[model samples]
Target: MSSGNSRGRGTGRNQGTGRKQEPQKRESILEYQKYENKMIRVKFHGGREVQGVLKGHDNLMNLVLDDTVELMRDPSDLNVITEKKRNLGLVVCRGTQIIVISPVEGMKEIPNPFQQ
Candidate 1:
């Protein structure tokens, strides 16, 4: 079967162009080097928080954490973390789901400012 148009008919991405396009470089915003091998807490978009030792991360923001454990929220109150839910050991926190990344040592619990 011979088609009339053969120039622009291929399964390749650069079908019409003669040369292939170069992929843009992706750079990571967080300095993983500073937090490497240190305890860090990552908060997800849905208020889920996880604590672990920072291992590595990619440009897309996906982080590899060692000894990862998800913080369990109080059964009565979703705003409070009662304890650790499970020991994940090793886990990858997706960049898209992560809302905050902070050092574990820097975190402190304070009384609610709005409670009257």
Candidate 2:
């Protein structure tokens, strides 16, 4: 008799399919590419926000940032926002935790900061 359990079977979403998943469109890559090595703001779940330099990223949209600064609002006064800066130097942020990424205004661009 065949086992009824579907576990361990490679039938999950975007998995175990014979066909290769199409590569990400160039436009999407280009859009994020422009932000590389630039100072940007990242908002996350639970009202947390961070600003840092875009160091690297992956297909999963995970990010590596340098000079990270975390922002938070005062729990007693929601209207009051506080800034806590830390010299993280480098950090890898999970893609699932990211809410949005926006370019920082009035900051000079660092051309090809990733070049060795």
Candidate 3:
């Protein structure tokens, strides 16, 4: 009679090859670690821009921003731009629509408003 258990046996796939498999390189849209917990400007498709503190992100580059503000340019006059403040407190932006992510220029690090 044979035991019905198959534990601790060399019966699994890719066993005993003695060759170390190379780690798969993961694709990422941005080096989000550097931008974490910092204020960043996110430019999206259709010429929309958002400025907020980068709260969090995922491998797909989907972002969670705090104290977000939406920036738009006047269609009639390209030079005339307007900003609409959003009270979302925390906003999640889809990665696919993101065009660029950059540090906010000329601004020092901002403290999290939610913490205070």
Candidate 4:
């Protein structure tokens, strides 16, 4: 009865693997300074949309928006927007889960371009 297995004491995991965990070198879209104090709309995944004044943004794409208004979607159709809306004043948006970010200025509903 050996007290402990001689070859099982040390758990060798990723020991000889030359894979060095490196941080992501992805560059930020940046240029958020110009959008500060300007109205912008951010559409997130899962069909969530919000509009607010750009207050501040960091290198990580995290946004500090003021006077944020979350646009409510139709229950029947997720792509449709209802007249109802909710105000989420002063919100911090995550860099991830952001699908689209556009300026509210000069923005209008356009017909589907895929239509023949």
Candidate 5:
């Protein structure tokens, strides 16, 4: 006698909804992908600054700095007047907590040699 009640399923639970699903939230700050392989100045915590041509980034968003140099270098070594060689190594910084990433002034966008 009560077979109708048992056969009814709860298919109308969400039938009243007329709104579309919300779109994904966009990032507030500018994304870093546009400036890949471009030279940039990154300011770290404690007022420390570094400059170099950005090489690449890892999956963790760590920046790779090639041909980098310290902001300040001692001039005493230049007085030696002898042949000396110095090699600069790569610098990597995690993007999760970088204080700032600013482009160097008067820096023109250069073509990426890797791109055909």
Candidate 6:
């Protein structure tokens, strides 16, 4: 009876530990996959940004931006990027590119501004 109890406790702890690790791998794969289906916002250096679905990526990872963008949900405000903001456009090159792929939930709301 004593040996059986110890085995049961060991099994229970192992099961709990296994459960936690399983989701993390699944979550990362889902994150990468989100770029394929959903619309993404790509921000470039020199203070330029574009909102569009990521259609393709080159060997150099330069993005091809389309003229017509399907804006699913506004990130903050519709007019977050104003006329005063400079260098804001599409077709980001290799050197000055910052691609932010949208998450599966559309736009993941975080406690504070952070990137994964």
Question: All models: lDDT?
Answer: 0.88, 0.77, 0.79, 0.87, 0.65, 0.47
Clashing pairs in 3: none
Instruction: Estimate, for each residue in 1-116, the C-alpha lDDT of model 3 and write its tens digit.
Output: 78666677555565688665577788785578887888899888878778899988888878999998877688786544566454556899999999988899565646669874
Total clashes for model 1: 0
State the lDDT of candidate 2 residue by residue for 1-116, as single tens digits.
77766687666577756776678664444367888889998888776777899999887779999998876678787645576454566789898898888899765645576767
TM-score of 4: 0.72
As a TM-score, model 5 comes out at: 0.47
Sort the candidates on lDDT, descending order. Answer: 1, 4, 3, 2, 5, 6
In model 1, what lDDT does residue 8 have? 52
Q: Please estimate how well model 5 matches the true structure, expressed as its whole-model Cα lDDT.
A: 0.65
Query: Candidate 5: where is the Cα deviation over 4 Å?
Result: 1-29, 58-61, 73-88, 107-116
Output the lDDT of residue 45, model 3.
83
Which has the better lDDT: candidate 5, or candidate 6?
A: 5
What order do you get sorting by TM-score, best first? 1, 4, 3, 2, 5, 6
Q: Residue-wise lDDT of candidate 6 within 1-116, one digit each (tens)?
A: 36355444446544656554333332222233336535566555544455654555554456554442433333476524544432333444462356454433457545645534
TM values, all candidates: 0.72, 0.60, 0.62, 0.72, 0.47, 0.38
Q: Show where candidate 6 strays beyond 4 Å.
A: 1-34, 67-95, 99-105, 108-116
**Off by more than 4 A, model 4:** 1-27
Error of 5 at 101 (Å): 0.3
Please give the TM-score that candidate 2 achieves against the real structure.
0.60
Candidate 5 on 67-95: residue-level lDDT in tens?
77545433564312233324355888777
- Candidate 2 segments exceeding 4 Å error: 1-30, 106-116
Predicted structure 3, TM vs. truth: 0.62
Model 1 lDDT tens row, 17-59: 7887689787776788899999999999878999999999888
Worst 10 residues of 2 by lDDT: 79-88
